[model samples]
Target chain A: MSGKLFRNFSFLSATLSFFLLVGIFAILFTYAQDAMHAFGIDFLFNETWEADEDDEGGVFGGFIPIVGTLLSTIIAMVIATPLAMGIAIFLTEIASPKISKGVSVAIELLAAIPSIIYGMWGLFYFAPIVQKTVGGDGVGLLTAGIVLAIMIIPFMASITRDSMNTTPLVLKESAYAMGATKFEVIKDVIMPYAKGGIIGSIILALGRALGETMAVAFLIGSVMSLPHRITDPTTSIPVLLANNFAEAQDLEMSAMYYLALVLFVVSFVIISAAKFYFFGKKAK
Target chain B: MNRLFVNKLILGLSTLSAVIGIGFLFWILITLSYKGITSIHWSTFTNDLVEGGIRNLLVGQFTMAILASFLAVPLGMMAGIYLREYGHGSKLASVIRNLSDVMMSAPSIVIGVFVFALLVDPFGGYNGWAGIVALAIMMIPIIISTTDNMLALVPKELREAGIALGGSKHKIILQIVIKAAKVGITTGILLSFARIIGETAPLLFTSANNQFFTMDLNGQFPSLTVSIYNLATYPDEASRELAWAASFILTMIVLCINLIGRFVIRNKK
Candidate 1:
């Protein structure tokens, strides 16, 4: 009887993730019906987000924040990928064991810091430096991207390192025996072996950058305009939601639900692709 | 000659990237400690947010996080046990693992929005229970992943030995397999606790923020992180300083817990 009870309870808890995922989707889709009826497909491309003069109902589209989310994630991926790859390479191939261990701890510590702390640091210490060097008012796509890059490098590096470390010793030794240099061994042997994991790590980091709230919220300037340049201010889905989700009502509230639905769907698809198509099979 | 030079260049760049990674970590830590130490006073910890101290915010944040742990830990561990022990590599277990992994990375703010739609909107306002639920949602996937992975690391021989001794399946898992993986699971629990305690996004509209100290779970709660978010954006010097002090303290608490988790695992090895 006790065994049966334990088994049944565990099975129920195991199903919780499926239920939670379905529940979130159902709730968001259910609530977003009004906005879906009003906007249909144009919501993705329509840039205007405003309320009517009476403050009851008006045009609310997802274009600016959607574009902002994509652009910021793009900038972050561009900056973070190469740096993260290099760090992974250093940890897996170049660094001595003691140095590697120390660096690993440092990277872990970096990853452990909260997103909000990154936001505060970026606002005070990093954004000013960006303003002085790169020329914007310091809070824009460029600053947000760079800070987001810093935030994800540790994650990306650690995963990439783990995958790269999985490369067989025999293959590397055979390459070295054939007179291959360190770089050649990495390029020819390790890269091909770890390609799935590396790409998956990059995509996963991209997904993270897309959804990151507080860090980007502080530096993305929270404006609703299209960024004319990389340094120009803009808003993202998360920043928009964080700054404005509370007091919104009526059609606007429905629109917020629509945006949330879009974010959840996009991230869901991205993470699914990374897990199933790229990294999942390889990991198994 | 060209190939050798290229190799040197690539290696040099990789090393430089490692340097850059470490450099940024130190830069953030140093700046945080400097600003945090400068702004902290006895009053900062003694007074509540109304008096510009973090006494209530700290208590409130911990209350929500601890309550969240109480909710997440058991459910997550049971789910993990189901996947690793009971499912026996079944297809259902694999699907749950995949979905749970995907859920682990679902955008946190979306979780907040979902919780708000359910707990806050229907109820008419933010409350401590809403915050706790949102955090538990964020933490469950992480705990599930860790427990599943740690339990997987236990040797098959242990389970066989338990079976040879005529132990029941559930008893074997509870005593033998779980005991074998105890250190790792404990570390995971500690790390997951560290992760949730620092989250600000999910708590943003759920518990929202309050100025005064209140222990009521049905009302708006004071959160150190949410308070930092609100205070840091203010134009006043005092508010910004308070934000700095809070951020510093939060970082220290998170990093120390993280180190302790790592230390426990290291000592085991």
Candidate 2:
């Protein structure tokens, strides 16, 4: 009887705690619903943000920020994915165990540095270099993307390495037994097997880049327009939310909240997709 | 000969890429030190901003971070404990676990917005208390996830031994389970501090940046992060330089926390 009571108590506590966790999502959804009613369907696709105007009211077109987020993340993925794959391949298929362990640890450390530090560094150092080389005023999509590439590289490399390492050794051995070359084994055997995980890692990195605020805000010029070129000044959604929240005008405030909700929904979808892809049936 | 050369070439390229990543980090640290260390005067550490330094902001940041962690760590640990030790395979537990994962991945700015709506807008003003609330919200999920992970790592035999010794479930958890997971819990707390210390976005809306210093929890207090943001954007050259210096200092503090937390966890094993 006492054992059953303890079990019941534990079960009840767990149930309550889980509900508390779900409550956070419920709160976000509630706010999102309110924002939708206030803004309507135009919230998702509109590109013009006129927070100061009346009658036409504050038109909150989110296209520029949306495009900026997607473009920068895509650029980051393009730059990071190959570099991460190379690092993973080198570690798993080439390097000695001692060097591989040390290299992997160093990469993991990069993941721990705060995003704001990356922002400060990008603003102070990287932007100038980018400006000098790329010939821009200072901040733009290219610089933000490059910085994000550096930031997300560790995540991509670590996960890819883990997935590659987990690929059955027997497959690699069999490939070698067939007189296949080293590069051929990795290309034909390892890469194909870890393909799902590699894609999942890229998606996860995309989610991170999309939601990144401080780093992007500092480096990406806070312009509310779409970029015509990688060097053109642009604003991302998180930066928009951060900048507007500080201004605290009524429309600006609501618009910021609406944009934040959009970012949240987009990131939520990407993260859920990544979880499904990486964890497979176990995710359910 | 060609195959051997190609293999060496691939290895060299991989080594070069790894070096580039590490080189960037070193370069950042070197530049931060050069820019910031020059301005490292006694006033920056000793006097209050009203008295011409950031003593108050420094102290305020410390207080706010500590207070937020205090609130967040316990609740998160409790939730984690409830989830890992007692709530196996139940629908409610699964829901909570998934919710915590979502919260973990939710954008920090979104969290800032949520806190502002729930706290600042309702109160019609921003305060340090609101900042603490926002930071605590961010800290909670991290703590819950880490604590739950650590608790799950505790060997079942230890728990069974305590149980066989006629220990109450509460006592077993408190003594055996928690004691084993202490280092991980501490590491979680330290990571939470690292996360909140440099956080500027959520605080942007909720904390309302203060230029001068104030210690009152109900009043606006300048934090190192907001200070960096404000100083960075100022038109003055002095402010921009100072922003770099301040950012350098903030980064060092965060690095110290992370390294120390890692050291502690490593030592425990």
- DockQ per candidate: 0.88, 0.43
- The superposed Cα distance between candidate 2 and the true structure at residue A88, in angstroms, equals 2.8
Number of clashes found in candidate 2: 4
lDDT of candidate 2 at residue A29, scale 0 to 100: 60
Q: Candidate 2's residue-wise lDDT over B1-269, tens digit each? A: 78767766766777677788778778878888898898667777886655546677778788888999887887788778877877756666766776666667778888788777777877878888889988887887788789888998899999999989999887788889999999999998998789788788778878766767677777676787877777777887767766776777887888888888888988877
Off by over 4 Å in 1: A282-284
Proportion of native contacts kept per candidate: 0.84, 0.43
| TM of each candidate vs. truth | 0.99, 0.91
Reference-based lDDT, residue A222, model 2: 88
lDDT for each residue of candidate 1 in B248-269, tens digit (9 for 90 to 100):
9999999999999999999999
Winning model by lDDT:
1
Q: What's the lDDT for residue B29 in model 2?
A: 82
Error of 1 at A270 (Å): 0.5
Q: List runs of model 2 lying over 4 Å from the truth.
A: A1-39, A52-56, A168-171, A281-284, B1-10, B50-52
- Cα lDDT computed for each candidate against the true fold: 0.95, 0.79
